[model samples]
Target: MRKPQQTPAQATTPYIDALLGYRTRGMVAFHTPGHKLGKGAPPIMREVFGAALLAVDVAMAGGVEDTRESTGLVRRAEDLAAAAWGGERCFFLVNGSTSGIHSLLLGLAGPGDGVILPRNAHKSVQAALIFSGAVPHYVEPTIDPLWGIPLNVPAERVAAAVAAHPESKAVFVVSPSSNGVCAALDAIAGVAHQGGLPLVVDQAWGPHLRFCSRLPLDAMSAGADAMVTSVHKLISGLTQSSAIVARGERLGLQRLESVVKMTQSTSPQALIYASIDAARAQMATQGEQLWSRAVDNAEWLRARLAPLEGVRVLSDEVLGQDGVADLDRTRVTVSAAGLGVTGYELETALRDDYGIAVEAADPLNVLLNVTYGDSHDDVALFAAAMTDLAARRRGARPLHGAALPANWPRFTRQVMTPRDAFFARSEAVPVEHTAGRVSAEMVAPYPPGIPIVAPGEEISDEIAAYLSEAAARAMHVHGPEDLTLKTLRVVS
Candidate 1:
């Protein structure tokens, strides 16, 4: 007997359609609106930007969903998200995770305060340092020798950082790095709370984690004071959708909201707002069923790729003692180590040659982010492509004659505040000659996207070499240096 195929009724289309038609009962706006729906915006508001933007800017005149104080649709959406993730409060974000991150940091820190951050963090956090005028102390995460990826910072590092900076305001971490390496969040939170500091985590790729047990624990459950998640990264929301999920009152929601308002657009897109509302509703309604499909698809892909030569799938082998909580199976991280080509090369070939776009391309690994939208057949196609790629690059010479270094130049020495150096008087000079000057921009490797030389750090000769070698291998680096590393931007 043949197994029954899944039905289309189980499709996410119905829920998505419902969200598309979501209605806010507010007035159509007429005073400021030329069409005159009779709402509360300036007369020029519609003319300055466009009618479409202001058309959706209706207030909760009668029965419309209110967003400011949250009564109808907004409250419902947030309640749905809160219940889905076990968070007490979940607020939608108009801008990307950048806005959410800045808000969280400002809520917890201020001038003269110090924050503990992982050395390998998004440049946005460093930017937050300038906005809030908070000093930052660094913590380096563990390196996985076999895969050549940076794992999560251990709990001990957070503890050490907090202890060293006794006045630290918050413990910040990125769980399940962009490469899919997770940290022990529970322990990290314990350390933060013990030190009387709230824990702030950036879990941008983990919106689906709450629905599935196979994934690692999300920031909210780990007792983090607040977390910022980008739904566009992995969830089914539009490209710029994100949210700030709080686990407690320590983060000061009022202050966070003010910051969010300041950074976000006054005339928010109803389309984006509706999408978030629908995403929240979907998760609230059938998260388990959808998330299970995504997980199963990823696992099926992992199993198929295991038989290929030079293709290694990380299991417990990649995770160290108390190093990671659980692997996000959805993010399929395949190390191209010993496969004769850098992940950057594979990424280009995959997209250009095979028409497959990977989530990220790095020197050692390619990250393929799977989501609820993809099916088992999609993963099958990816696995087949990898099989061919493995065969093609086997005899290719490495970009660097020597194998990847067993160790990287340690991230030592912080000379100035990242914020000051970024906005200060700076010059663009040759990379080779930029050794002593403080960097004025970020030079980050792709897969991790963490800055080795951020705006305020002094670049080392060893750090420069790792990047040049990586570029030779076709790795795409972002920020000041143009991947070639011929020139770097620096503070004059």
Candidate 2:
């Protein structure tokens, strides 16, 4: 007879068991935690977290330590996660996927090394570049002129970038953008491996992809060397909890572990670890059913909104574009341009008037995320609110002025690496006068967090005009001390 297969509960939650076992043992107070597992803490403090939570708030040493020879339960939990996500190794991240991205960069590439990435990457990718002192070879993502949104980067771009920068250490890509548009990761990964490089994917918004058949291919399944995903984004984990999964020998596990540990807190929270493990268990056991309901709920809402004149709910047809291979239907992105309102105005109205919180917004579209936790009732309420707003917009003029420039400003020159410029002598200058100067800091528009200006980039007239226009339109621009765009930081 064949050996019995282990159940989901048996495979996952090893760390949870270890934590709970130690919590239930009722051992003497821990050594480090000043609270000593709620005993030394004030009654109110204990009351705040409640007995059950405080009970498991033990240190990593006494309670959870198994042995040096045998890999601990935390390692087991990570192993289970690796198996669940289809990776060779999985590491639990308590500092969020930001840390994982940093780890991937720091581990694979270092000072003077090149890492090819897309221009529409998250700010964390830039931070990782700075941390690793790696030079970035930026590829432009496909831009949708009609919607004013960046779609996926094509695989040919990745291949061409790799060919151009044959000495580059790794290729990095982000899939299922915040608004749910996805790249062709399998093709991209094949391109990277063909050029003798590892692919590092920042799948921070795609934690549920592996579990849902309807979702796009996850980084692991696509044969990425390494991938970082934020568990809290779509999976039911604590906010800071994430996982970085890796495969193959192209990238060393030791280096990845070092960078991860260096960035992570020495005193990692047991609660966060437990939550991640529990989330893995939940995903392993019941994710398909949960995602089915979520997709149904999203479709229900989209169907209701599609008939409304003012709102145009984006469908999977957008995936048929040249670069976009797939679209995550869970993101109910509805364009408000036809409604004669800015996405910002629509977001404000939804929150203030209807008490509905959306995920994000750009000038044209407001994004609503449907997750396992969402219900049909929740969708019904949001649909009704949107319907009311559509009815109220009886040919009102768009509150916004002009659509953003079709093409964003491209860096004409790189004065220095991001690390060097960030650390070099810097001074603040009037934004208008800094057009020709190399920037010492990043300047990004908030709604779509891509950086219009990054360290070491030569700022251009087009960039200045775009930023000024964004500010004039009351868009929240981040990374600049002067919110009004009057001044900018530049390398002297």
Candidate 3:
């Protein structure tokens, strides 16, 4: 893997430096953030976050850069991030990748316009469709029967969708899915461009891909017209920090910027912006070394766990399967089905017994995110915990069920546009009666956050049954009026 070199400008943290300078100036009584530099902060807040953090938790207007006018420091930081990520322009996001996704969809599509996107996209995409009033042409992603998890959407499928819906304003897809399965983005981008549509990637988990050559190709390098990354997911940035990087070839930057600003909070946090800037600088300079270490740590943990009885570590074996063109090695997925335990049970055991919490756990697999922040000691502890768990569960009968039901329903037919159904009068109906009814809310499993039933979609018997089974398994259901799954909201 080639090591990345950052120019002097790329290595500078202009936003962070400016924030620190502002804090050092010791201006009396901040205009907003009633904390007054930690003095007015609650005792518990001061104790938990410390005075230094509160001191710099300043507003965007008078504290860092005036939102009304240009100070150029924040712009410089965003420009450097754009250069680092190989995008024509970049916008730092304080509201996370959700805002970025919203901006992308709203900016690219108008009311009643069509957008082709994978079925396994995040709930934010559905929310964006509702906000933009865009009609969705859903593309089913390849599902791995072994794991019952949704994989990448094939380029051919995208091409077919584009051919079918020639009126689509843009093609959006999620690369390196929540399960670490990456799409053939280069091919997909080509297909979208050939159809005269810009390709937008929801790369929320892959902000580090651009900096590390060892990782899968980033969206920008894969010819995506636009992409959003959550800098905090696998990098050093704080939570809710993200970046929207876009090339203005097809989607105008002015429109994107306007939509982004509209979706974003006017009272944006300075710390989040500074963290994004700092993260970009750090990744541009030392990403190769840091991510190399993280990859090594993940591999070492995988190797250590491979020999454990009944534990299967997923690695490069998933590549070339379905639409998975590459794998993110840092996401270590361990299947504990052979140990006669559900992933939730294994997760509970690890958290309760070993005090180790993984990223997310489904029925058969627990996802462990190993990043630059992890050390050899951390991986060793995890390996040791897995070894102990394996030993304790040895010779147990293997679990016989798949992660998802064999007859799991695909995306149901759209009875109404998401926006129309969302705004239409709706009422709650029994789960069993939901079949054949147009859904007024999204119902999705929480870990992966892909909706099984989106607003305006006709709920089928298979989908209702699958959702009932999922609820019985105690999986967290998101975006529904009733979390118990007893009643579902449908168009009246």
Instruction: Name the top lDDT candidate.
Output: 3
Worst 10 residues of 2 by lDDT: 1-10
- Candidate 2 Cα misplacement greater than 4 A, ranges: 1-11, 39-48, 66-71, 399-407, 481-484
Q: For every model shown, what is its TM-score relative to the native structure?
A: 0.84, 0.93, 0.97
Give the local distance difference test score of model 2. 0.82
lDDT of 3 by residue, 320-411 (tens): 88789999999988888888877788889989999999999887888999999999999999999989888899998888874545333777
Give the per-residue lDDT of model 1 (tens digit) for 341-458. 6666677788987889888766666788888889887898898888888788777554443444425556856777777777888887876677767887777765466777777787
Give lDDT per model, in order.
0.71, 0.82, 0.88
Top TM-score model? 3
Rank the models by lDDT, top first.
3, 2, 1
Off by over 4 Å in 3: 1-5, 402-408
Q: Model 3, residue 74: displacement in angstroms?
A: 1.1
Candidate 2 has a TM-score of 0.93
